[model samples]
Target: MFKDRLRATRISKKYTAQQVADYLDTGLRNYQKYESGDARPTFEGLVSLADLLNVPTDFLLERDEYLDALGVSVDVSLECPPRRPKPRKSH
Candidate 1:
């Protein structure tokens, strides 16, 4: 799935493997391993790929069960919780 996601995003954005390699400052063969799922990128490389692909890092790396484990849920509302008033001083 990681391979598929990487290849799909790269194709959709009209970038070749060599172009991605250049952007990453890596050898083409090394970068190809990432798209083949034979190797995974280092943490820094993951961030760079996410930035270059214009996708959230999670979009490239996350699985559904991982989301559940993280207890993350999306909220569309922009409202902030109300702040509490200051307590009165005793005489």
Candidate 2:
């Protein structure tokens, strides 16, 4: 499910395997392995891919069932907290 969803989203977004590899700074062969399900992405890599695909990380992990089990609604519109400004150094 993870492999299929990842491939579908990538294709839907019109990204080639090489494009995804370049975007993630991963090797083409390694990225291909991910799509083939011969390899799984690390936690950080999964997050990066999800961000690039504009999908939830859980979606990539095929964890929607877990979300359903918890009765947690998925809302992608939740805004991230704004970055706090760096403190100015006193001269």
For each candidate in the order shown, give its overall lDDT on alpha carbons: 0.74, 0.78
Scored by TM-score, the top model is: 2
Candidate 2: stretches off by over 4 Å: 66-91
Please list the residue runs of candidate 1 whose C-alpha ends up more than 4 Å from where it truly belongs after superposition: 64-91
Question: Residue 88 of model 2: what lDDT?
Answer: 100
Query: How accurate locally is residue 41 in candidate 2, as Cα lDDT from 0 to 100?
Result: 90
The deviation in Å at residue 4 for candidate 1 is 1.0
Against the true structure, candidate 1 has what lDDT?
0.74
* Tens-digit lDDT string for candidate 1 (1-91): 7776777777766788899999999999999889778899999998998888877667677554665577754322223333245469999
RMSD of each: 19.8, 15.1
After TM-score superposition, the amount by which residue 38's alpha carbon in candidate 2 deviates from its true location, in angstroms, is 0.6
By summed lDDT, the worst window of 10 consecutive residues in model 2 runs over: 75-84
Per-residue C-alpha lDDT of model 2 across residues 1-91, encoded as one tens digit per residue: 6777778778767778899999889999899888777898988899999999887787777788887887765544322234345569999
